[model samples]
Target: MAPTDVNRSTAPLSPAPAGGVPGWPTGLTGLGYGGDYNPEQWPQATRLEDVEMMIEAGVNIVSVAIFAWATLEPAEGEYDFDWLDEMMDRLHAAGIRVALATATASPPPWLTARHPEVLPQLADGTVLGQGGRQSYAVTHPLFREYAIRMATVMAERYKDHPALALWHVDNEIGCHVPRDYSDAAASAFRSWLAERYGSIDALNTAWGTAFWSQRYGTFEDVLPPRAAPTYANPTQQLDFDRFSSRALLGYYQDLRDALRAITPAVPITTNFMASSGTKGMDYFDWAGDLDVISNDHYTSAENPDRHIELAFSADLTRGIAGGQPWILMEHSTSAVNWQPRNRTKAPGEMLRNSLAHVARGADSVMFFQWRQSQAGAEKFHSAMVPHAGRESDVWNNTVALGQALKDLAPVKGSTVRSRVALVLDYEAWWASELDSHPTQALRYLDQAQALYKQLWLRGVSTDVVRPGSDLSGYDLVIVPTLYLVSDSGAANVAAVAERGGTVLVTYFSGIVTPEDHVRLGGYPGAFRDLLGIRTEEFYTLQADEQVSVTGTSGDLVGTFGADLWTEKTHLAGAQAVAVYDDGALAGLPAVTRNTVGSGAAWYAATRLDEAGTAALVEAVLADAGLTGEVEAPAGVEVVRRHGSGGASFLFVINHTGTDASVKASGRELLTGAAVSGDLTVAAGAVAVVQEG
Candidate 1:
């Protein structure tokens, strides 16, 4: 069954817009469906067949020219727009819009060979050679000049094309070449440092240069933290990570500005690798600059919990978009070519996966490519049309998903409102696990995914926001393993509790500043006042060691296990929610909850086991007034998206082995079945309802 039609417009499909910019494309009226189109790789006959197939699959948009620099300008300063023009014209004629790329993701061979200085270099000073993608250093002057020129040229040529919907700046900006330590990068880093610190002495103080007499005499004397005799400076490494992320963002701005100056009406964005696969670029800093938030996700076939991770990625992307509807720019239609063992999808898995993204907040669903490549490194990658052509499940699923999205037109422009906020700071994620910490077992995403997964399994939607965000509207705020925080940012989190909201802070958080300087007085120094607890020292447990904890008195009741960490924690004014029953800190408080103003602040001194975490989470949810009945069966998932006029669309996904049901009253969009009080869902299937 496909999605039911939600809108009765004159045209069910959309073409490239002719004018003003909207949240989505001006001309599109329904959920978007398409994939990447590399038309230059095929002949004219094949291109025609691809267009016909797209129409049959209900594709309304396609991303073109992402890695077409080599074809667009095979020679220096010489250009060819013939193939792109033909493709754009043909797609528009077939009612397919284009998310046009600048073709600057990778430079042409001629340019790279002519200006070898633009090549990226490793930390050991090995300059990367050509023959791969993303070969150019972002901060290299020549590379920036060439890429900016490329963006300007493409904007000038396609400014009037009818197939232009969105301007895809560059494909996955930091996927391959996230960091470079070349001479150009060194210069840029120095300039960035100078701007940030203003003086050499200030920079030395921030970097803690007095410890080993490593202070620099001038800005020019500094270099990247390259392969040294031993471990490099922690603060220097932290600063470079910040500088590199800024440098890439600056490069994107350079291109985006050029495109905006020429074509002011078209929206521009770049695909972000926001999934667990990438961690280099701080996407929170990149969100404000985007006209639309887009992300690419790939799940491992080996992970039994891949669906939960997908839910996390989608929710995090939607949060980055400020809870607005965004696009799923690229995902695998089946087994991807990159994993160690690429296993094909089971029956009905693809449909469930696509709807899961839509349930989270994706207005459009797209894949890596439209047709399976017969040649190149990604030839083994799955696509909408596999080598088996129309008979393959991939193609059949693609067609089904397309019609399903078209039927979800009413869901377009709706937003997902999350009352819970999970603080996720990229800088903190980078700094928390840096060398020379309390324990090597401390991982930022590990702690975050653990908490987020529990919430997901409970059918509770979450918003992953940057630390220091305004938490006024949220009833529950969770800060997980945040090792770095600014003073004002910490105050902002504290104010959340001051306003009668429940706040949960985990261990190893609030330990450092932005410059990697340890917070003085005590561990979790920033939140000590709010949490009403003091931690004297950290106890790092061995791999095989485990600890036991038990709940105390009223409201908090459970006896559970923990591992990998402990702390000599003493309660200041708060009561112990859970106390360590066995460990170095036996009989001391492992978890405490302090009433602040009218709200409460809870702290965990160690990583609790699964049962303990779930128990604690349940109590916190009750404290925040979020407790409720099971809306769906045990393994079934339910999320609602709110639209205008109190209208909501309920998405129910059944991941269990047998049939399950949830209570609701609505017209089912997927099967056109009427649901009243009880809604039945088959195993491993999905349903969407326009709830009244």
Candidate 2:
């Protein structure tokens, strides 16, 4: 059949919901199905063929021109939109929407050659060359000026285009060049510090510059804490991290303003790399700028627990977006090209992964590229239409997933609710990783994930939230390794327990302020009163070190062991629920619980093993009288999404190779069959049930 004879004019493309944010183009009738499209890479004939294949697979949207600055503007003051115009018109004619990108992520070679200062400099004083994406310094005046100019030109050209659905500001801000230690960045850092601290004396006190005679007489003397003789000031390094993130955000804001000036009605967003352990930018702070939150997530094929990490990232993104539906901007259809040994997805893995994001409040599931590239750095990256063409399994799965999304149209505006909130603060992550810490083996994300995995295994829904956010709605709040706490954040946690809510404070928490300075008087400073315990000192253990612990009462009666760290704590008013049997701190309080007002606060003073952590979490959940009724097997996941008018959808996913059963009663939306009692899900399968 010829490409033109397919007749996809009647394909489902619903209008944007009336309740959606203003200026955002709507009409996405079902889950969005598409990925990045680089039409300029292929010939005109091939581009047309790609569009035909997309229509056949029910692809309704494509993000275009993300890295096309070099092609869009070949020379200074020269602009070319002829190719992009034709592609947009063709896709629009085929009933495909466009998430048009501004192409500012990578500067053109000509611009880089003309303005070499725009290149970012490493901490060792090596200037990065052009060729790679995100090579320009975000604070460079020339770079920002040219980026805004290009963005304005693109916005003016495509603001009213029929195919334009949303404006993607730039491709994954801070992905490559997150930090630049160049002179320009240093100057910008000084200006940022001045704005933050007002005067030089204030900066000195906040940074504790009085130590080691590091006090500065002027802001100009401050550098980027780059490659120092020994340990650079921890507070200075923390501030530099903050400045670099804000610098990238400033660049994004410039382009966003340029787009908004021309197309006030069009919504704008930049894709965030919300991978686990990513600390470049604090996304919680950036989420407010986006009209619709979007994130790129890629799972590590080597990790045996990648699915749990995926669920954690999705839930965190949803929480950052204020419990609103966000976009799964980029994922892989099969194997990704970046890993050491890329592995292809198992039979139903792609579908299951996409549905996992949707199950956790993602409205769209998109990939990196629409079609595989024949030449480029990412030639091996998987796509909807792989190099094997339309007959391949990836293409078939794409078609099938698109059809399934049509059946899931009712889940568009649904949201997830949780009675448990796990505080995830980026400042704490940065502060804990600073040099001269008590234990070099302590990792922020690892500890948080350990607790999150336990909660997930227990079938308890949780929202990974910022500390300053409201905590009144939650029955149980878990603060995992929150090493740095602001006064307001500390007060927020205290208020949770004061308001009759159970709060759990983990080891290595509440040790420092937001400025990376330790809280004086005692260890675990700010939380000492709330937790009813005072830590006299921290005991860092070696790699092979282990300590024996036995619960004295309630759920802690069993004997368990902990490793990595321990604290010599004195109970103020809290009762010791568990104690270390052998160690220097033997017979001391290893875990304590205190009754505060109408609620209780629990504290753990050491890193517990998986079973121990699970047991402790079980005890905390019991205290709050909150436990999930569903007791799912190891690899099975159960999630619920609530919609308007009291409608709720339950998602049961089985990640194992064998069948898994869950007690569920609802109308299965996918199969249109009534489900009651035991619902057996096949291996690597998912079931979406709508509850009455």
Candidate 3:
């Protein structure tokens, strides 16, 4: 069949106003409804059919040429933009904008075949083969040279194209090849350490080499903490992780600068993986390098609390962007291909998930690819258009979601206002997870997310912030297991309590410096003055063991179980609010509260279960003089996005199997119907109200 042409039309909606972030590219109008469009995978006739289907589904933007490196340049100096030009022109004629990717993520076979040294090496000195994507070493000079040249060529070619809306710089850095333990990596690590510590003596002192006789005579003597017979040096391993992240960031900066020099008008972004644990690169450190923040989120099908995890990732992404609206660059429409067992999404699940991202402050919702691949490693991955064509349920839901986003276009520039801030430090996460800890079961993200989940369940919006970020606007601040604390970070937490604000610090916190060295004065050494307590010893428990906690005063007047880790704490001046009921440390304080200046600081010396955590969070909320305005039913989420000049949009989402009702007054944006008094939302449905 021959390809058919179509006429161009204006965008469905208007561009969102540039929020506080200045120089934000203004090409996108309305919600962007599209995914990665790789026309190179299909025939030209099929490509035309895709455009028609995209127009039918109201997709206005598509990311193209993400992995087209081999096709874009068959030879070292060869350049070919003919096929790319045709696709761009066709999409422009169909009223669809393009997010042109640099196609430098995976270098071509020819380049790697010529220079096998570009391949990354594993910890055991095994060179990675070139069959998989992201196999090149980030520190390789030739790799950077080629990547910059490819990006520069693409930027210069598409700078003035009418369909170019945004520039996607090399897909998902540090995803597949986060670290390399080769000779090249060792040299780079030594250089990074020299810049950080200047002298070998300073490095030796920071690493505490005297304990293990691992002292380095010079920078060149240090290698990337590779696999040893026994356990590797923890401080050395931590520094290698930091160096690896910096090397990848250097590659991203090279490509970003190349694009910025050629196409200054276009916004540049690279999608970040906001997973629960450490993803090698600290997104908080990398967030500033992006013109617009974007993230790729995938829900765990096996986990029952997947929605809450999704919401956590979205909120963290928005917080990293300084509370500005971010882009949901990729999400599965149904089931993804990567998991051990891929479970399909239930009815209305897709719509609920996309709106969930928007409710948390995402301006655009997209996916990995537009059509399901017939072959490849991700052939089983679901897409906007499934294998069953336009008649499939995925297509129907896709169209419905498109219309829903069109109706909710007014939420584009609105900000999600949060009164509570939860400190998220990547450095603490890295240092706390090092080998040889008190308890390997204690994870940084798990403890932090547990408290954040409690606030979310109560319909209380909170922002995930860095440790050193400004906390003046928040009423309450929560720091969970912050093992690595710099001087400035500790001062920031103290300032929060001194300014008539409440703060909560959990167990195993403030135990180390930024260099992964223990503070040594007492446990939680950095926060002893503010918390008014000092820990004598750490009691690590087995998986099944738990200690009972009995409250003596305040809202914690009941029994709770504490597990994983416990600290024997003695209060200096603070009053004990909760005490251990049964254990060697019986009658000792498990929870303490102290007044600092005008505000108060609370410390939890042990891990608390769900109910206990919720009780503690509620008590802190009361201390901050804040409460949820609307009491929502179980499995239903309530959030508000505030626009300029007192206008607000209330998002009520029902993640339940049955219908739910809430008392509110406003006009529902989805249906344009008036909602007064009691509003009933259908099962797995969403109701966004525009309120004054």
Candidate 4:
């Protein structure tokens, strides 16, 4: 696939509007890195020195004032833009772009104390105080007004600043907890219900409140659904999740809209935490208004596959942006002190991870701080200049990374034309986890992630998408853990299956509607006919219990296990590709494939390990005419993104502790190396290759 083939998966191939999101500026040709620069916390003399150090470190973008809302707007009606003006001026003079934040992360202590209604409430029903940055109630008018005013003031002040590159909305909404249950949110929740279902009667039907006599007779009768040990309502929990998500979205939208009014040319974005069970803030919905999707990613050190998770997250951001370039809003330069065990990023780990983002289609790479803080919760987090100043190993690493990025700047915002796409939906995530019937082991993200690694390891370019997206171009469409499906959604898959495209729909699919009610007819309700299967029962098997299935073809010829959520499946016209090899329910259809009009739909009745799942998906992929162009060397990952001309860039990353060999058939731009299959990529090193 070439650069022109990039939009084949996208229904709309036309360029975005002049001032709209997705339009690349003239001469914009490379990646940008550096983020969260807070000079306000440092003295003027020290701050001036820090800027020079950041430049030496390859810092091109600076995210300013994420938690300075209180300082920006000290009094209810009074506003201050003096400090911001000076900061912008200095950054512009230094040739660094700015991601001007709304500074609404934390409300002033005075405001929260003055109007207690402004505080957020935890899911456990506890009112959160002003202890963290994410304690504001979304529905509070005071909070909204103050946030909008600050955003408006900032936009107006720096609308013409040459350094103003993007607008950073209020920092990570729902990062701390759910919405408040205060009078304002309670009242707004009722209004949100009215818009979603129109009337209490309709809401009752949608939620299936008829069960357990939970039907609502009036808006006033509604409350945040809390499940106790004795009683729990899945329908209510689902609704609250939806309501909470919408509440946070409303607050974010307000700020985004306000910024749009002032600077329509610049992109507006907010960072999101990945895989946080959709407590309702759908990244899709949030992405609709953002200029560029951005996020703050900090993974646990104990996980060796943290790099893979980071890739998945970067893909999620691209998915939200509809395949446009995303920004790595924040990553730690070294070990972060916030986590229980703060471990440093190995010698070249930061560069390795940052290149992973660029390989996956990130427009920029950024960190949490430019200089280490002497105070605050993140004071101990590693920075380019640690508290020990420029004499640290961290600072040296930062300078080295900066030089490397400059060397590899040719691939910024390049396109990776992929004919393979894996579907991931937050709506499905919210619906599935909110269910009470499924086994506790039926997790959503991990399952999708497992399948993601299959394509990733194979060096196949894969895009993560939601339902209703165009699937006409891809040879293979993989939907893992699609726990919820509407009538139209099922039809979307059916269309692709009918058009000679192979489809893989996994367990926990078609279980609920968008409103979270179980589909009326049966499991996999809307898709039953297309899938040619009906499930009569599903059981929770013990951890140690095992099942095996032999593949109908390919390397998957051996048996595999079905540990949890084993669905007793009945295939109609579909053939059983694998079966449970043990237990009383043994020899059942653990995996099946139904030939639709022109293609086929594969169904997995239970979760399997990465090797097993990848084997199954690869088997299906082979039938769809999909094949990888090259096999990346061990520990050396490869990905490509395209530009306008014949220039195609490829990122080769070595994320292991030991050096690895690579066979490069194309030109390697980073090293100016000629085509070959025999080259060594140093440990934690990155090579940017290009096609001229």
**TM-scores for candidates 1 onward, in order:** 0.96, 0.96, 0.96, 0.93
lDDT per residue, candidate 4, 1-692, as tens digits?
Answer: 11111001112212344744544322234677787887778788887787777767767788898888777777777867787788888887887888888888888888888877778766567778887677777777777787787788888888888888878888878877654667667777777777777888988888787787787789888876643554457666666676777777777777776777777767777887754233347777666656567877876687778888788877777777788877778888888986777788887788888778878877777888888899988888887778877788888877887777777777765767788888887777776775455576667786788887777777778888888888888888888878787778878878888998888888888777777766766667767887889888776678787666667643356666556767888888888888777776677888888899888888888887656787886787787877664566655678878887788876778877677776555666666778665657788888776766
Report the Cα lDDT for residue 418, model 1: 79
User: In model 4, where do residues sit more than 4 Å from their true spots?
Assistant: 1-29, 74-81, 227-232, 275-280, 552-555, 665-667, 676-678
Error of 4 at 405 (Å): 2.1
Candidate 4, TM-score vs. the true structure?
Answer: 0.93
lDDT of 1: 0.86
Q: Write the residue-wise lDDT of candidate 2 on 1-692 in tens digits.
A: 11111011211122323554452335565778789999888998899899888888888888999999999999988888999999999999999989999998888889888899889988889899988788898887777788888999999998789898899988988887788998888888888898889999999999998899999999999999888789999999898888777787777777777787787767788899876847898888787678888999998989888889999999999888889998898999999989888989999999889999999999988998898999999999999889999889999998888887877888888989999999999888888888888888999887789989989888899998999999999999999899999988989999999999999999889888878878898878989999999999999799999998889986666778899999999999999999999989899988999999899999999988888898899999999989863778988989999988888888988999999999888888788889988788899998898886
Could you tell me which residue pairs clash in candidate 2?
14-27, 14-29, 15-27, 16-26, 16-27, 23-265, 551-556
What's model 1's TM-score?
Answer: 0.96
lDDT of 2 at 543: 95
Ten contiguous residues with the weakest lDDT in model 1: 3-12
Ranked by lDDT from best down, the candidates are 2, 3, 1, 4
Candidate 4 C-alpha error for residue 378, in Å:
1.0
Candidate 4 or 3, higher lDDT: 3
lDDT (10s digit) by residue, model 3, range 1-692 = 11111111112112322443232435678877789988888988989899899988888888899999999999989978888999999999998888889999889999999999888999988899888898788787777788888999999888899998888889999898788987777777887888889999999998989976898898888988788887788888888877787788777877877887777657778888986843688788787778788889999999888888888888899888889988888999999998999999999889989999999999888998899999898889999999888889999998898899999998889999888999988878888888899988978887888998888888889899999898999989999989998999999999999999999999889998888888997888899999999998998889999999988988766889989888889999888999999887889999999999999999999888888898899889988988764789988989899998888999998999999999888899999999988889999999999888
State how far residue 128 of model 4 sits from its true place (Å).
0.4
